[model samples]
Target: MSIEQRVTEEMKVAMRAKDKVRLIALKGIRAAFIEALKEDGSESLADDRATTILRRLAKQRRESIEAYEQGSRADLAALERAELEVIDAFLPSLADEETTRAWVEEAIASTGASSPGDMGRVMGALMSAHRGDLDGKLANRLVRELLGS
Candidate 1:
């Protein structure tokens, strides 16, 4: 099934199990999908688009966790962590290290990205090549390391 349908099903399971964190996260995800559909004037979201939205949600949770920890709010951080876990459940798995590394190398070669100045070019190529399956943050770090940045 599609990610969206899976998420809806999972939400029902979470509700039935009375898993508060998962239910909340799933609700937020559903809300996000609805908002996106309305904004884009689309009847349905592709799996890739849903994955992208989930990734963004996970990123937001990660940032919130970091900020809460920095502010000495362990309780909030823990909550964010729980939410992030739920968000991650819906995202597609990233490429393995070897696969990602190979892709990075290919992107660099294809983009002629010999220096950090070409980082954007390489990143664009990598994202297009991998679409929703690549971890963009990790790819960027790999690109920087490869380019000696």
Candidate 2:
């Protein structure tokens, strides 16, 4: 099933089970999907787009958790962490640092990225090929290190 469909089904399950955190997370995802569809003027979202949206939501949660923690709001941070767990359940596992390094090396070689100036080319290739799988920050660091920057 498409991610949206899966989320919808899960929402029903959450509602039935009275899972407040799961329901809230699912509702947030549903709202984001609806907003995306309205922006695109489309009736359905591709799985790729759905994954991107989920990733974005997860990222937001992570940032919020960090911010809350730094601001000394333990209760708020805990809530964000709970929401993050629910969001994470739908995300595919990320590639490890080692795997991301290998991909970065390959991208550098394939793109002839011999210097820091070629970081953009290498990153563009890497992200296009492994958007949802790899950690972008790790890949960027690898690219810079491999490029002797």
Candidate 3:
């Protein structure tokens, strides 16, 4: 099933189970998707785009958790962490370090990126290959390391 459909099913289950955290997280996902659809003027989101929205939500929650922790707000950080877990439940798992390194190598070879100067080309190729499933930050770091940057 599509992410939205799966999310809707999960929402129903959460409501039936009286799981407040799960319910809230699902609602947040719906809201983000709606906002994206409105902004893009799309009839419905593609699978990859929906995944992108989920990743964005997850990223925001992670950043919020960090900020809350730094501000000594444990309660807020816990809430953000809970939401993040729920969000991550919908995202594709990131490739492990080994697999990521392989992609880095493939990206470098395909793009003929032998130096940091070609980081953009390598990144563009990798991002295109993996789309929403790719972790750009990690990929960039790996590519830089491989390129002796």
Candidate 4:
């Protein structure tokens, strides 16, 4: 089944199981998917689009968690972490450090990126190659390390 279909099914399962956190996250995902479909005039989102949406949701949750922690709101931080866990259930397998490093090397080679000056080109290639499988911030860090900048 497609990612969209799987998410819909998961939403129903969450409802049946009375999983409040999962249900809320699923609803948010469904709403985002619907909004994207409406905006693009498409019946279903492509896999890449779905992955992108999930990643964006996860990123937002992480940011919220960080902010909550900074504000000394543990309860809100916990909630954001729960939501992040639910959203992460649909994401592609995250790349490990070794894999990320390998991809960074490949990106550098493929883009002929020799110095920090080519960081943008290298980052663009890496993001395109590893989207949904790697976190953008982590990827950027790895690229920077590889470029020694």
TM-score of each: 0.91, 0.95, 0.92, 0.91
Per-residue lDDT of candidate 3, residues 124-144 (tens digit) = 899889876667888888998
Candidate with better lDDT, 1 vs 2: 2
* Tens digits of per-residue lDDT for model 1, 6-101: 889999999999999889989999999999999999998888789889999998999999999999999999989999988888877889878899
How many Å off is the CA of 121 in candidate 4?
Answer: 2.0
User: Candidate 2 lDDT, tens digit per residue, 38-110?
Assistant: 9999999998899899899999999999999999999999988898898888888999998998899889889
Tens digits of lDDT, candidate 4, 1-149: 88899999999999999999889989999999999999999988998899889888988999999999999999999988988988888888888998888999999999999888899999999888777787677888988898889
Comparison by lDDT, 2 against 3, better one: 2
Models, CA RMSD each: 1.5, 1.1, 1.4, 1.5
As a whole number from 0 to 100, the lDDT of residue 71 in candidate 4 is 100
Q: Show where candidate 1 strays beyond 4 Å.
A: none
Scored by lDDT, model 3 comes in at 0.89
Clash list (residue pairs), candidate 1: none
lDDT (0 to 1) per candidate: 0.90, 0.92, 0.89, 0.90
